[model samples]
Target: MRIIGLLLLTGSLTMGLAACGGGDEQSTAKQEKAVETSTEAKAGVEEFTITAKNWNFSSDKEIVVKKGEKVKLNLVNKEGLHTIKNDELGIDLTADKPAEFMADKTGEYVLKCSTVCGATQDHEGMEISLKVVD
Candidate 1:
């Protein structure tokens, strides 16, 4: 019957729309989980190891910590030479040694590669987010 064929087509369309609608809800849930995880990061002397190669950072996860905590960063450069620097936090680390800085304030800070290791670029692929929460 004509009505049966039309009903089947309508059902298929409705199922497709439901699948699309679920995508947004899943994304929102992921965002919330990230928030919870960031807040629950281990406090006091947070140690992080970063691999520096291919002109990019190996770890893109945001460095989250409470204010007034110490951030201990260990850098390893497998490709070329590199250093990490954040002007706001006065963190300048060379490949020769590790870096430790105080998360003095509660705000968002950007860390970048200050050393000129890459080609024709002031900042290589080393920009990452640093968040200090109260």
Candidate 2:
């Protein structure tokens, strides 16, 4: 009877250890799958920086990107405090925050400075074009 009890205890311990190891393997697989998904999401995103100066944006006058692509626009203030907005594209960029969106429409959207800076002429020319193409 003593020998039989010892064998039962050993078998129980082995099965418990095997069950724990299986759970760990499943957890590791889930973690790896999450990492792969994160990488794929970041790979499809495009990042751009728009520098705002005293009277204009020092970056490209026409920021072009492909439609149906994820876009991330970062605003950098070089000379003055500025803000950019486009009602149609639903973009509102500021010196403190960035703008992120998916370029769903293919058209030319005007981005204008929302803040009043310097003189009227300076503010008037503080406009850029966001061109979304196929």
Candidate 3:
């Protein structure tokens, strides 16, 4: 019984010593790095806003943006879950939250809502086309 008690005490001491040996320094360093990364990410982007409602976009035309520019396509949904997708011209946006995209190239592109919430005949309550210029 004494041997078992001694073994348990030793085990607890060993574990406590190992835990207090500055092993958390590595984790602290990683957390600092993550904070730095988050700051950097917020610094590297530009912003823009768009509103969607009823059977039309707020602007009856596509937004013209310059190439190599960071665009935060802030879409405001006044009704349903709207989405925007343009894989070829590099535009994948969702209307649930403000969407961001970069105009990497100079060309005329089509941007459309990926979420088909209603009728498909006349594309009511959906938006399409965004022209990107050099």
RMSD of each: 11.1, 14.6, 12.2
User: Which candidate gets the maximum TM-score versus the true structure?
Assistant: 2
Candidate 2 per-residue C-alpha lDDT over 23-42 given as tens digits, one digit per residue, 9 for 90 to 100: 64585456445434544667
Give the candidate order by descending lDDT.
Answer: 2, 1, 3
Tens digits of per-residue lDDT for model 1 on 1-134? 99999999999999999888866458545644543454357455676666667568665355788998888766656666778898788888665576788888999877788887757563455666778999
TM-score for each candidate, following the candidate numbering? 0.59, 0.65, 0.54
Of candidate 2, the 10-residue stretch with the lowest lDDT total is 31-40
Predicted candidate 3 versus true structure: per-residue lDDT over 57-126, tens digit per residue: 5642347777887766655555556667778855666544555677887777666767776788535436
Question: How big is the positional error of residue 25 in model 3, measured in Å on the Cα after superposition?
Answer: 48
Count clashing residue pairs in model 2: 0
Worst 10 residues of 3 by lDDT: 53-62
Please report, in order, the local distance difference test score of every candidate based on alpha carbons.
Answer: 0.71, 0.77, 0.62
What is the number of backbone collisions in each predicted candidate, taken in the order shown? 0, 0, 0
Error of 3 at 43 (Å): 7.9
What global local distance difference test value does model 3 have? 0.62
